[model samples]
Target: MTARERLRDYHAKRDFGRTGEPRGRGAAVGDEPRFVVQIHDASTLHFDFRLQVGDVLKSWSVPKGPSGDPRDKRLAVPTEDHPLEYEEYEGVIPAGEYGGGTVIVWDHGTFEPLSHDRKGRPVDFAESLDHGHATFRLHGEKLRGEYALTRFRTGKDESWLLVKGSADHARRQGTPDPRRARSVHSGRTLAQVAGNS
Candidate 1:
């Protein structure tokens, strides 16, 4: 499906008139692939993990955010494809709107596909995703090192598992707690970004 068609579900759920989020219309981006982890304080706090695939941002709602521990397999629920400009979105979504609450750009940067085929040949990222698995390395500010997203189940909505690479390389450094972490883009906490602080 085309990227614009892929965003149909996303647009259907949200009321642009009630939220400040950008409409998933034409978004100009560079050739480099991009990734973003958005801290969304909705009814419940969760991280919106997004990777630029094709012309839209393939998204997953990670409940526990991402960990620096390989043993920590975070649950990632597949969400709708978002626009590329959504990477810069950091504000409050009106109360009656879908996913209404504060949003912050937690981490964002370029990513490289780390998936390979049986013969150790590099596999296309889209192909890897189609096969229900994708391995990639993130070079974001708050998050670094390798990470993998594997579809563990398929039902009403798809569910995936987000895991870090190795324990040694997964160890987090400064600002160990993600809840207390500030936005890499604005240096503001969720509360501050929401204008509640």
Candidate 2:
């Protein structure tokens, strides 16, 4: 399906007139696919992990945020697809909105799809994701090296795991305190963003 079709649910959940969130005018794809991790201080504070798939961003709600440590297995719950423009979003979502809260662009950068078939042939990143697993290397300002997202459940209880690969790029450090994390775009924390709004 096209990006427009994939974003229907996202659009339905949001009222463009009231929210500052983008209406998702399809953007031109760049040479490399992008990934972003946004800290969302919603009713339940969490991280939103998004990967560019086709023209939209396939997203997930990561409760504990992403970690640099290889041993950290972060639970990731799938969410509606988002617009490419959302990568730059950093502000407060109004109260009573679908996701009313403060938001900050925690990290974002290009990524290299590393999924391969049993024969070692490069597989399409979207296809790999559809099959419940995908591996990629992130080149973000704060997050680098290899990572993987693997779906562990499906249907109503669907969930996935985001784990840092145990490669040379893996770090001994894990995720920082979400309240203390600053936006890569604005250098503001959730409290600061909310305070300004």
Candidate 3:
């Protein structure tokens, strides 16, 4: 099973609030994983949202970035699932292409999900992303909390918000200040690393 494949499976049964809206490509239908997330600062200024599903990555692009708190809605737009290999995607995306600009693996790590279906067991992430609210219980050293990905609009995979819905006393329950999260690629920012690596 690939991420793209799983994404397709999840949607086959998803209500999506409407029909034929192209919310996602409805690729491979498979099981969505728990606590899996990857952030990619794209060729443009947008940040990519990726959750593990099957063998590929269920993806989206966030413009404002991830929130550390539980109140801020950091718009997350839905996008097609990229191969797991995409986790390593960095640099520029050519000058005249679909996304022509500089793409830096600004930061990369993992995230845990805490959302469940109406039954409250755990959400089958792959299929549930279309539900519009993805509750993530992050376990990463840098980001730890009960967070969420909410759909804010219906633009070109560039129209959603990654909202931090709630948090425990250990984590902020709202928006996180960028200064609080140090880059995870280690000591350097993505650009610095790309230049040197």
Q: Which predicted model would earn the best TM-score?
A: 2
Top-lDDT candidate index: 2
List model 3 lDDT by residue over 1-197, tens digit each: 63445557445543445322233433443343422233333354556667666666767667666766655667666676655555555444434444544444445556666668777788766556667666766555455656676666654544666765553643444333322333444444445534553
Whole-model lDDT values for every prediction: 0.86, 0.93, 0.54
Model 3's alpha-carbon lDDT is 0.54
Candidate 2, residues 1-197: lDDT per residue as tens digits? 88889999999999888889988897778999999999999999999999999899999999998899988999999999999999888888899999999999999999999999999999999999999999999999999999999999999989999999997466788789999988898888889999999
After superposition, candidate 3 runs with Cα above 4 Å error? 1-44, 152-158, 170-183, 190-197
**Which ten residues in a row are the worst by lDDT in model 3?**
18-27
Q: Candidate 1, 83: how far from true, in Å?
A: 0.6
Ranking by TM-score: 2, 1, 3
For residues 130-192, write the lDDT of model 1, one tens digit per residue: 899999988888688888999989989779999888834667433245567688898998888
On the 0 to 100 scale, the lDDT of residue 175 in model 1 is 25
Better of 2 and 3 by lDDT: 2
Model 2 lowest lDDT segment of ten: 167-176
**On a 0 to 100 scale, what is the lDDT of residue 14 in model 2?**
95
